[model samples]
Target chain A: MTKENNKVTVSRRSVLKGAAATTGAALGAGALGGFPTIWAQNIKNVTLRQFGTGVSNLNDVATKVKEDLGFTLKMTALDSDSVAQRAATQPKSFDIADIEYWICKKVWGAGNLQAMDTSKIKNYDKIAGTFRSGKLTPESEIAQGTAPHTVGFVEGPGSKKFADNESGWMTLIPTIYNADTLGIRPDLIKRPITSWTELLNPEFKGKASILDIPSIGIMDAAMVVEAMGEITYGDKGNMTKEEIDKTIAIFIEAKKAGQFRAFWKTFDESINLMASGEVVIQSMWSPAITAVRSKGIPCVYQPLKEGYRSWGGGLGLSANLSGLELEAAYEYINWYLSGWVGGYLMRQGYYSAVPETSKKFMTEDEWGYWFEGKAAKGEIKTPTGKVLEKAGAVRDGGSFYERMGAVACWNSVMDENKHMVRKWNELIAA
Target chain B: MNNTISPEKTSWMLVSPLAFILGLFLVLPILIIIMVSFWDYNEYNFFPAFISENYDYLLTSKVTLDTYLKTFKFMILVWFFCTFIGFTVAYFLAFHVRTLPMQIALFLLCTIPFWTSNIIRMISWIPFLGRNGIANSTLISAGIIDQPLEWLLFSDFAVVLAFVHLFSLFMVVPVFNTMMRIDKSLIEAARDAGASGFQILTNVIIPLSKPGIMIGSIFVVTLVMGDFITVRFMSGGQSTSVGRVISNEIGLLQYPAAAASAVVLLITVLIMITIMMRFVDIRKEL
Candidate 1:
């Protein structure tokens, strides 16, 4: 009996030592694994290059790709148009592109991006059905354009071709999406600003700013034009030449009268404009509005009665992708849609493509707080674990589905995008 | 003489490395831009075909003309301010300071801000100029005004001020170099001949400082002409510059149009420089 007891104690001690050794090995591997050149000697390696705009949280997803698939994902951050320019003119520079829907349409027109095989994406069927379905609110129904999230596929293969089956292909995979609205400083405005026309209201003269980006800025102006009882666009996304001219003329008239304090060209500029009280109101991204609030400014990303201008970003395979590069690119896409990436992006005010899958990585409270718009059960933190919300703080737009599902119009590349850019330049010059 | 290489050949050898660098980086890119300016582009793609549509549209547009006038307006205003400030500071340092160490120290003080990022320096003015900023608050406390100054932050004044702050150093460096090189004997002779301070400055100093002023003018004029960020940020986007138009066009992926605008800007700047150059032989002076 004494010998048996001694043997049992020895086994228990050895098991504990083994567990400690494994943990230490994992920690060392993680540190050394960051160096691709050293690891490439022992492992079969592929470098998956990517170009994108507004994909900062993807650094974590790159780590996931390295651990799961033994590949190095190199991402280059660029502006929206730069990404399109590179994808269209130099598709060989990158294997994957994180681009907007309209950009994909533009690049796809140039036969630069390949159709994504959805069969390889394990979470394809589990992606939010509402996003894929073409159903729209009554406002959108009358608006007579596809919903922002309705990314249609061509049911085939190759660059331009696509398919909408379980095994079908698409030009891009839906990833991060959000609803955007005007961020307003209520303390300065000192009144309710419910309508988009308020962006142009003379009362706010020299206290309003808009984005300098032509494609997105024109849409915001179009919303204001309609809200101000001017002629409404048939489709705000793909406005006709007449519609664009009419909207730009309104903007030019307003600009001449000093309707804007500044035209912000970047996220930080927009935030600084509001935070420093340079502008009382401006078209702002959700994250920027959050940043301003974090600065202790009385800012609100208001849900205008005209509804939010929504947009989404997705991933596309470059036409130059082949062999191991192609296989690794697909693997990265699958891993990006996995639960952890979705959860990570959700904490940053973006809705994940596959919410059900993302829920696996998040607590029930996090789901309720982020998606259901419930008050935080405990302290809620950002992806990097900075305290974003204290207990009992509620989300701004109520629920993710309610906010994203009711988008008025998606940011688009209009049919008259070139003419629109000229008009936009004229407005700025004026 | 028969065995020795010609002066031209020796000079060419010395300049070849510099010529190669200039040709590779500068002349080649400018030529490519000129070439691309004539290319045709649609919404998505640019085609490498010779066409005058971009230049035609740019040259014909009223907006382009107005934008050029605005840019020229900014350039003239900024140049005047920078030259005046730069000359005063340089004169104080070069002549009045007297001690070499103090002059060098003050000169270094002027350039210390340049060691940091230009963007940071540009943005550091925001808090100072904002409506509720330190300047306004100080003024308000002093009973200088009842209301916070609105124009202090986001108007033409702010744009000019930011430019003078940034480009004044360019003027100072060149003007100071020339002032330091001016013969002290000449100024003493003018004073001995019963010249007043004003007379000495106007006749002896100003005439001798022409090369420095011309060089300083070149730097200031070119910098303000090429600048868009200061105007874009400081003027609250109410102002537009020629460079801003090119940048905007590029951002919109209108490469051909941007190239055309760039070509026009380059020609305009070159003409201005040539006119300035006629005022003083900068190469001969250097």
Candidate 2:
């Protein structure tokens, strides 16, 4: 296996060298009109390998890039955990690492990715203020936990440490994000559910679920615990060792009492649990709720009193990416934030970083329905043109501002992450 | 120069390819895991260092003991069901079936479900055993039970059910091979000596089938102990196994801890196999 990996690496290097020589010769023979045509021809040979979680590493986006930029965009979609593992461990395997903000906290220390220059990101000034200043509006209190802007910027291009405020250099160019909440099967429950505390209500015993991911799951647990009046954490995002212990203990007791039906780790599992009526209420992503509803089920991404636990994801260039490849990666990021890809992702219940740019690509009805909290003027459709909601249907949890503004916390990597993971394993074992 | 190679040299030559393959793939990987198990790790990276903390924590933690016990429970339960069902099926095929072609055809029929992916077969059980699934709906319609049985799915029962469904074939193939080789003359002699059919089965056939049973037991035991996905899926992430513990750690990028857990599991599995080997001389039987 090692021998084969080495051989592939060597052949790729030789290919890159050959491409560089050809580009150099083309430059040497350049004339004003012919140079632009030669450059376009050579760009067709460029292939940028990108990888991320299944949420946004899409084939449609790759196809669009191929059509518009005349370059190959090879995309690999892994689970969130695997995406982090690959980004931190295999620096040379990919050109772009599209990952979550919490994952950036983990991968940034490894220095596998180069800090992106904000000036080159055509729409950087137009990005959502939530990703730049950790607030929806200037008056909005920054949510607790690892908010995107905290780790989004660095001191300079060569810096590894995260800067306190926005610098010219960025760790990741913000792309897509969403405010997450509990999804409930209202037909089965037949009651008003409006709080995170509802997750642990014994009345819903054997019908409640949470994701099994340790870092994110712990934050969800903290929200439930705080709402239930069990413990008040200083920062739910960065829990102390004692805070972690108490939070896990509460969940373990609930588990023993059979309060949980199951803990899901993937998007489809959440949809399956809700669709099958196996789980009545659970912490769920926005898209999973949409998926359950699309299957003709009555599922709600319930707005809780305690607020949503939000996360953001973005594209980061690999440190190994340089020269033509680096320029192409920058071009891809600029295109991503420009309009079409943003609009495509926004249609799937996620908010694009540059909502203004996405608005241009979407119809007025689509914009009003998805982002302005208005009832659909007509039938709303997914990016694939499948009917999502009928006329008179409004998006769950209301408009983008209301949902993103009410975010109580962001998904975080705690200071005591190791202890939390160990305790989490114990919770599973128990 | 001598044109002919010596016997010992020829024997070494014959074994060299297999040795090289094992060394590169198996032995080297095991050695790396062992080395990594003793190293130190933080959140983002594992570094080379002589540290016992990973092992110390694993050996002393109550969770580790509980996970091991849970894994063992699964192993023993799955082993019992697989062995009993496997032996009965093999016995019927060997003694009751009259024609070789019929026996071969029946054996091939047993493998029909194996054509699809293992994950597909395991997941197919969800719709059958879920709250509103076929089993519960059927029970409700017949007035057999008013409420759905919650334990039918996402329980220890489901985990064991999937395991037995997936791995019984492993037991069937080996047991059937040995059952086919059992001497007919021995059964004839037992009958002539006034032994009943039950006595013939107990005295003549079972003793001869020990080797196959041992081999099958090994297969079932190791597979159950090493499995994480089946337990994770069938139990709906409500249950834990030794493999799951290691995998969870790996997911968190805690490699040294995961390696330590893996090393302990490997040792435990090895000890179990060694204990089983003592009950039967497998090489002589084969």
Best by TM-score: 2
Error of 1 at B9 (Å): 5.4
| Inter-residue clash pairs, candidate 1 | A154-A162, A155-A162, A155-A163, A156-A162, A156-A163
- How far is B47's C-alpha from truth in model 1 (Å)? 1.2
What are the DockQ scores of the candidates, in order? 0.56, 0.76
The top-ranked prediction according to lDDT is 2
Top DockQ model? 2
For candidate 1, the per-residue lDDT at A158 reads: 62
* Model 1, span A29-139: residue lDDT tens: 785454333333322335667778855435777787778777667778886767778877887788788888777766677777887777888888777653455443333
Regions of candidate 2 where Cα sits further than 4 Å from its true position = A1-16, A26-36, B1-5
